[model samples]
Each structure stands twice: as structure tokens, then as C-alpha cells.
Target: MKLIDTKNQLNDKEKHIGKVVGVDNATLTNIQLKAGEEIAEHDSKNEAIIIVRKGKVRFTVEGKPVEVTPEHILHMTPLEKHSLHAIDDTDLVLVQVKP
Candidate 1:
């Protein structure tokens, strides 16, 4: 069992996008992007959900472009190819569930 204050972790330092923070049965990742910053295309072996914490981002999911704002929650199934770009300064959290 584990409990964490993810916000506290954020306050400790600013992170680059797609940084894996913690992992057990799942992965906890912290993503922060400056305007024009991007994470290149990649596929995940596990299912993932990306929570937009601040600003806006562009997601390319399976070759489709998706605009994601702080109000949206993005889900990616296992083995899905995805990439991200910041439309503005952004903060996001990626939670990946592993098998």
C-alpha cells in the first residue's frame, strides 16, 4: 500500500515531460512542458491515463491529432502509439497501469 501527495512532489522541482516518477504495479509520471516543447511518438506496453493539470496540449493518438485542455482526461490503451506537444506551458500527470 502507498499514499502520496503528488502536488508536493511537483513543488519540489519542475520536471521535463514524460518523466517516470514512481513505479510498482503502476507507473506515476510527472509531465511539464513549456510552449513548443514536445514528447516524441512512442508506444506504451501498459494502459495509461493522462490528466491535464494546467494549460493545453496536443496529443497524437494513433496518428489522430487531439487537442487536450486542462478540463480533459485522456486515456490510452495498452500498446497504443502516442505523442504530446505543449500548446502552451503545461503540467500533466500520466498514470500507467501495468499488467
Candidate 2:
């Protein structure tokens, strides 16, 4: 078995993005953003599931605003445009599955 560490160690002024795993038809990504940082609008070709592990963010999905917190999870279909702003220092895991 292989082991992967998915951890966020960013300081208050830092942000990070990285791939944690990729196997067959699926991929796992780790995204961490400091408060006020944003990811500009973009779309994925694969289906996506976003798990919020800590802090809060406001996601603009197709021009609509959705607030997400650590207690919430988000999903998107292929090619659905979305962007996000960190409402607080945040840690997120993105899982993408191919068709």
C-alpha cells in the first residue's frame, strides 16, 4: 500500500495548491487559501466534489454566490464554471472523477 499525506501547513500569509493523488479515473487535489485570496472563475472537464476541511469560503458558481463552511460540501458537474474567495483561511480537498 502507498501512503500520502494531505496536510495544510501554510502560515497566515501563505497559500498553496497541489495534487495529492491520481489513479485511473480519479484525482485528488489540495487547495489552501488565506483569507481574502481568490481563485478566479474556471471550469473543469471532469465531475468534481469539493470538501471543505476548515474555515469558510464564498463560491460563485455560474454567477450565483454560495457560502461554504467546514460543515458543508460542494459538487459540480463537468464544465460548470465556478470561482471562490476565501472568507477565512481555508483548507479544501477537491476530488475529480472522469467519466
Candidate 3:
């Protein structure tokens, strides 16, 4: 009964790459990265699924290196330590579920 056009949410401000696009039962974030950009190490406060919308990214999850490409997805559990880097220009959607 709802529709979200993710493409319109893409935003390229000074030095930004992520934005909260929706929040209800779950939190949805639109994340984009220019080549060589990175999201420093952090912990997920809730369960999250990172959906690759375009390009590629290198994700270090719990110290394990993984490459996620378009159409691929990465899951993170609560308090999971992870980091992400764009090997190329990339766009992603992060949906986090509240516990």
C-alpha cells in the first residue's frame, strides 16, 4: 500500500553518503559512496540488511573481508562490527530492523 522511489533519494552533498529515507517498523537508509570513500568501523545497534543497488564495495565484517556487488546483500546482527569501502562508485540500501 506504499511506494518508495529510491533513486530520487540519492543525494550528493559536500561530504555525505548516507541518509535516512524511511522509518516505521524498520529504518531504511540510502547509502552511496564515491570511489575510494569509506565508512569507518562501527557497530550495528540492530539487525540490518545491506542491499547493493549499484557498483561494488568491500566490506569488512567482524574482521573478515568480503566483496558485495549489485543485487547482492549483506546481513548484520545486532552489535556486529563492520566497515565498508567503495572500490568503485556505489549505491546501497540499508534496512535495519528494530528488536
* TM-scores of all predicted structures: 0.80, 0.92, 0.84
Checking candidate 3 for backbone clashes, the offending pairs are none
Model 1, global lDDT: 0.81
> Candidate 3 — what's its lDDT?
0.81
- Candidates, ranked, lDDT: 2, 1, 3
Per-residue lDDT for 1-99 in model 2, tens only?
Answer: 998896776863488999999999999999999999999999999999999999999999999999988788899999999999999999999999988
Q: lDDT tens string, model 3, 1-99? A: 577655533254422445566566688888877778899999978899999888899999999999999867898899989999998878888898988
User: What TM-score does prediction 2 earn?
Assistant: 0.92
* Best candidate (score: lDDT): 2
Candidate 3: where are CA atoms >4 Å away? Answer: 8-15, 18-20
Q: Distance from true position, residue 50, model 2, in Å? A: 0.4
Assess each prediction's global lDDT (C-alpha) against the native. 0.81, 0.91, 0.81
The sequence of per-residue lDDT tens digits that candidate 1 reaches over residues 1-99 is 656444433345444644556667787787787778888999989999989888899999999999899889999999889988899878888898888
The better candidate by lDDT, 2 or 3, is: 2
Q: Which runs of model 2 end up more than 4 angstroms from their true locations?
A: none
Q: Model 1: which residue pairs collide?
A: none
Cα RMSD (Å) per model?
A: 3.2, 1.5, 2.3
